[model samples]
Structures are given as C-alpha cells and as structure tokens.
Target: MNWIILILAGLFEVAFAFCLGKAKETTGNEMYFWYAGFLAALSISMGLLIKATQTLPIGTAYAVWTGIGAVGTVLVGIWVFKEPAGFLRLLFLTTLIGSIIGLKAVSSH
Candidate 1:
C-alpha cells in the first residue's frame, strides 16, 4: 500500500540522517562512505515519497513523512549518537507520534 511505501520512505529519511551524523563523526574514506550512504538513502526516500504521493494527499503525506523522520532521527540520536533524552523531548515526541496517527486516521485515502 501507499501508506507502507510512505512509511518506508520515512525510514529511509531517518537512515539518511543517520548517515549524515556518522559522516560528521568520521574522516577520510570513512566519511566519504557515510556520505555515499546518505546519498543512496536520500535518493530512495525521495523516490518512495514521490510514489506515495500518487495516492496520498500531498500535505498529509509530507507531514507524516517528516514526522516519521523527526521521530526516528531523534530516537537514533538517543540510542546511537548518545544524545539527550530528557522528559520534555520525549513528551513532544509522543505528541508527534499521536499527530501522525491522527493524520492517518483522518486522511480521505
């Protein structure tokens, strides 16, 4: 389904962000490799987003896509990059997840 595609696209967006983070922490060939991964993930994410938009409303799809990317990137930052996971941050993340669900539920498609 397009929703599944959209979700996958969002995941790729997170992957691209992860790649960028990793690239930032590395050097030389390793940095270049991470940048390559970023490019690949970015390409796939955009492609799937374009596909999903064929069936889903553009506004809803974009919001959900970015929401998923934001949530996933934050979690990745906490788990992988050892970033802060304070109370307020988690609270906002929960709300964002709820909003994404609400958007899906209210979508005409």
Candidate 2:
C-alpha cells in the first residue's frame, strides 16, 4: 500500500514538472491555471511522500520516488515534447531504473 501511494506520488511529481514546463510559455490567466495545477500536484505528491515515509525508510522512499519521476519525465519529454531519443539517453534511463530496483530489493522494506 505504501508502495502504491509512493508510485502515485511520483506520478504526480511528473505531472507537476510537466505543468511547470508548460506554464513557462503561458501568459496571465493561462499561466495561472497551469501554475495552480502544478501547485496542486506538487502538494499532493509531497503529502503522499510524507505519508509513505511513515512505513518506509526515508532514503529508500525518496530515491524511488525521484527515480519514478525522473524516468516518467524523460519518457514524457520524448513522447509528448518530441525531445531527442538518443541511444545513450535511453540507456541511462534504463540504468537509473535498474538502480532504483536494486535499492528497493536491498532495502528492509
């Protein structure tokens, strides 16, 4: 259950980051909407992280959450923003995922 919450929190982090990126180009009311969405997602994500930490070690939870966000952001950037999909970039993302899994496996939780 904690893992599930942590995963969703990470996804929210991704949403927050994406919204922030989009907000930069927006103006006035448009920017305000994106900013609000970003703030809401950020708050929810942080709340979930704090909750998950009650059951999971802070180090493990933080690393996993960041890993999820980073991977999601990279994938979203590639798919939605048409960013570069170079071989090296993908390889590093896979490596990061492997490290996240390794961390979880070794953790007491």
Candidate 3:
C-alpha cells in the first residue's frame, strides 16, 4: 500500500538524519561512509515519497512524512546520540504523533 510506502520513506528520512549525525561525529573514511549512507537513504526516501504522492494528497503525505521523520529523528537523538529528553520535548513529540495520525485518518485516500 501507498501508506506503507510512505511510512518506509519516512523511516528512511530518519535513517538519513541518523547518518548525518553520525557523520558529524566522525572523520576520514568513517565520515565518508556515513555520508554515503545518507545519500543512499535520501534517494530511497525521496523515491518512496514520490510514489506515495501519486495516490495520497500531497499536503497530507508531506506533513505525515516530515512528522514521522521529525518524531523518529528526535527519538534517535535521545536514544543514540544521547540528546535531552525533557518533559516539554516529549510532550510536543506526542502531539506531533497525534497530528500525523489525525491526518491519516482524515485523508480521502
């Protein structure tokens, strides 16, 4: 389904963000490797997004895509990169998730 594709695309978006974060923390060959991973993930994410947009409304798809990426990246930051997970941060994340779900529920497709 297109929704599944969209979700995978969003996941890849998070993967690319993770690669960028890792690249930022490394050097030389390792850094280049991470950058390569970023490029690959970016390509795949974009491709899936384009595919999903064929059936899903562009606005809804894009918002959901970015929402998933934002939520996922933030969680990745907390778990992998040891970023802050304060109360306000989590509260906003929960809201973002709700918004994404609401968009999906309301979508005509």
Candidate 4:
C-alpha cells in the first residue's frame, strides 16, 4: 500500500515537473492554471513521500521516488517537450533505473 502511494507520488512529481515548464511557456490565465496544477501535484507528492517514509527507509524511499520522477520527467522531456535524447542521456537514465530496481530488491518491504 505504501509503495503504491509512493508510486503515485512519483507520478505526480513528474506531472508537476512538466507543469512547471508549461506554466513558463504560457501567459496570464493559462499560466495560472498550470501553476495551480503544479502546486497541487507538488503538495500531494510531498505528502505521500512523508507517509511512505513512515514505513520505508528514508534513503531508499527518497531515491526510488526521485528515480521514478526523474526517469518519467526525462521521458516527457524527450517525447513531449522535443528535448534532445542523446546516447549518453539514455545510458545514464538506464543506469539510474537499474539502481532503483536494485534498491527495491534489497528493501525488506
């Protein structure tokens, strides 16, 4: 259950990250909406992270949460934002993913 919540938090973190850029891209009313969404997502993500830390090791939980968010945000950047996806970037991303998996495997819960 905690893991599920943490994953949702990570997804929201990714959403907020994208919303940050979208907010910057727009003007006036549109920017306000995006900013509001970013704040909401950020709040939810932080709350879930705090909850997950109650059971999971803080270091492992934080690493996995940020790992998910980082990987997700990177994918969004490459696909939706039209950012460059060079070989080195993908390689490091895969490495980070491997580390996340390793952390999960070693975690007792």
- Residue-wise C-alpha lDDT for candidate 4, range 13-105, written one tens digit per residue: 999999998998999999999999999999999999999999999999999999999999999999989999999999999999999999999
Root-mean-square deviation of Cα positions for candidate 2 versus the true structure, in angstroms: 0.9
Order candidates by lDDT, high to low: 1, 3, 4, 2
Off by over 4 Å in 4: none
lDDT of 1 by residue, 2-92 (tens): 9999999999999999999999999999999999999999999999999999999999999999999999999999999999999999999
Q: Which residues of candidate 1, in runs, are more than 4 Å off? A: none
TM-score of 1: 0.99
lDDT tens string, model 2, 27-102? 9999999999999999999999999999999999999999999999999889978899999999999999999899
Q: Which of candidates 1 and 4 reaches a greater TM-score? A: 1
RMSD of each: 0.3, 0.9, 0.3, 0.7
- lDDT measured at residue 8 in model 1 versus the true structure, 0 to 100: 100
- Put down candidate 3 lDDT per residue, 36-68, tens digits, no spaces: 999999999999999999999999999999999
Over 4 Å off in model 2, which ranges? none
TM-score of every prediction relative to native: 0.99, 0.95, 0.99, 0.97
Q: Local distance difference test, per candidate?
A: 1.00, 0.94, 0.99, 0.95
